[model samples]
Target: MPPKAEYIELKKSIDTLIEEVATVKEQQKTIMALVEQLDQTQADNLEKDKKIAILENRVADLEQYTRINDVIITGLSIKPRSYARAVTPENGGEPAELDVTSTERQVAAFMQSKDIQLDCNNIEACLPLPKRGTNGKPSVVLRFVNRKHKIALLKQGRKLKGTNVYMNDHLTKRNADIARKARELRREKKIQQAWTANCKVFIKLNGTPENTKVLVIRNIEELNEYDV
Candidate 1:
């Protein structure tokens, strides 16, 4: 070939190579932009997950706070038939319905027997829970005008341990389940002592120097934290 023809062919090849480099650079820029967008989306999702966790914790705290003023008395013997007959007329007439008054009087008498020194006026409400099966005595739920009186009653309840009386905080169903599990753990020798107070389940491990561990259980998912 002639020299002029060779020079023209080389110049055309150089132009094509430059265009290819520019295209590659544009593709690189697009890929980088997509990667940056993905990073931002992941960060936003992480922050949202954190906020959701915080909100869930706050809701649990609020639920527990509502039950702080309530207390439960178990092992209180209640013979529905006897009590029903006691308030009835001797003429074999219709049995008088047992109202909250009768239940309150019974609770007051129990407290007196325990020497708890609680005023009847301080009791805001009293009701008996449904009898469980045949052997379980119906528990009594007591609401006080103030939490202080409830605390006092609970403190004095220690004296009735040897007897058939037991007292505990009135926890919600979720906390109650946790408390039951905690006791089961203790029975299995996994923990030294497990109890509920202020609607929280506490576990004390044997040979541990620290105090009891507070379990913050929300659902079955959270139980994994306690190795449950």
Candidate 2:
């Protein structure tokens, strides 16, 4: 009611309002700091993921490089009876049946028949893969002493298309799965052609090599890049 009493009451109200404003400013500062920390954490996680991806790719490249000198031959006629028989050397040496080189010699002979310049000496190692079922002959997985020999065989393999003999580059399991899926895509009419060369998978969506762009499939996920 009096001027002095009214002035004191207004001063008290102003002080209370100032305290509430200060509290709101402090809360705003705390919220902004939390948001900044979250942004930094996300950026750090993204950097870590990129590094892991780079390391994985390098390991895959090394695995493929080791298999560059290997190839697999399927549909070769190798009888089970002669599977353990010894093979005589070209120099007219004794029949070395205990050595179990009959398969190697047979594979060497088969390659020669195809006009691919190779011999038992060129074969660094040879092992017959188990036959899928009871009927067909087992596929031969072989490594060459020289990379050139593998390349020569691959180049000459195209002529054996109509015949039972088939050859393919030896690929890592990851790459093999990718190749298998690529071929499946081709058979499904989703792609023009898909094959493996030097242990790398490739796909041609459509069109000729001149017009169409061929894609190299490094990982299986890349297969999804094509629309068809």
Give the top-scoring candidate (lDDT): 2
Tell how far residue 158 is off in model 2, in angstroms: 2.8
What is candidate 2's lDDT per residue for 47-146, written digit by digit as tens?
Answer: 9999998898889889888889998888886654343445568647755555444778778777777777666678899878888777866688889999
Model 2 TM-score, 2 decimals: 0.74
Residue 192 in candidate 1, Cα distance off native in Å: 3.2
Error of 2 at 166 (Å): 2.3
Per residue, candidate 1 scores C-alpha lDDT tens digits across 91-164 of 47766655544777887887788777778788899778987798877798888999998888888877786887
Model 2 stretches astray by more than 4 angstroms:
1-21, 75-97, 109-117, 130-137, 162-165, 207-210
RMSD of 1: 5.9
Q: Number of the top candidate by TM-score?
A: 2
**Candidate 1 residue-wise lDDT at 44:** 99
**TM-scores, all models, native as reference:** 0.65, 0.74
State model 2's lDDT: 0.82
